[model samples]
Target: MAIENRNICSLYDDEKENLLLLHSAELLENISQSKEKYRKIIQAGMAQWVKGLQEGRIKLDTVADLKLLIELDIQLQKDEEI
Candidate 1:
């Protein structure tokens, strides 16, 4: 639903709710946990991708899309210590 241009209160209320969530510890922790889970999933995918490459299921010349997965894995690994 669109907020009415004349309804300043609606905008103010939405901003206040966003600020509350920003300061919520539960929300922050949940976000951190979700990121770690997603990182693990991507790592698993990378492992399988390597297996495919070794078994000749994946082609060396058809690695353009794999480059994107590698980039994302690298970016996430930069944040993950273990």
Candidate 2:
């Protein structure tokens, strides 16, 4: 037997609105958690990068690369404001 998809339009307006609200809340929660996870990962990676630089394990020779990293960090900071 083939599974059939139900038409959302068949739902009453209030029911549709409730469903949409529930879905939106779930999506927002997922987005929030994902952002937090990525933020922690980025922070850890940055700490390791800095440690490597300090310990002479990594060498950055170009001003452009350093500038780019600085710009990216700045953008991440701005994102936190939202």
Q: List the residue pairs that clash in candidate 2.
A: none
- TM-scores for all candidates: the values are 0.59, 0.67
Question: For residues 2-58, what per-residue lDDT tens digits would candidate 1 score against the true structure?
Answer: 756755465677787876877796876787798788878878887888899999999
Per-residue lDDT for 3 in model 1?
59
For residues 5-59, could you state the per-residue lDDT of candidate 2 as single tens digits?
A: 5789777889899999999999878876876776676666677778878998878
Count of backbone clashes, every candidate in sequence: 0, 0
Local error of candidate 1 at 13, Å? Answer: 17
lDDT of 2 at 1: 100
The TM-score measured for candidate 1 stands at: 0.59
By summed lDDT, the worst window of 10 consecutive residues in model 1 runs over: 2-11
**Alpha-carbon runs more than 4 Å astray in model 1:** 1-23, 77-82
Candidate 1: deviation at residue 5, Å?
Answer: 34
Give the Å shift of residue 42 in candidate 2.
Answer: 0.3
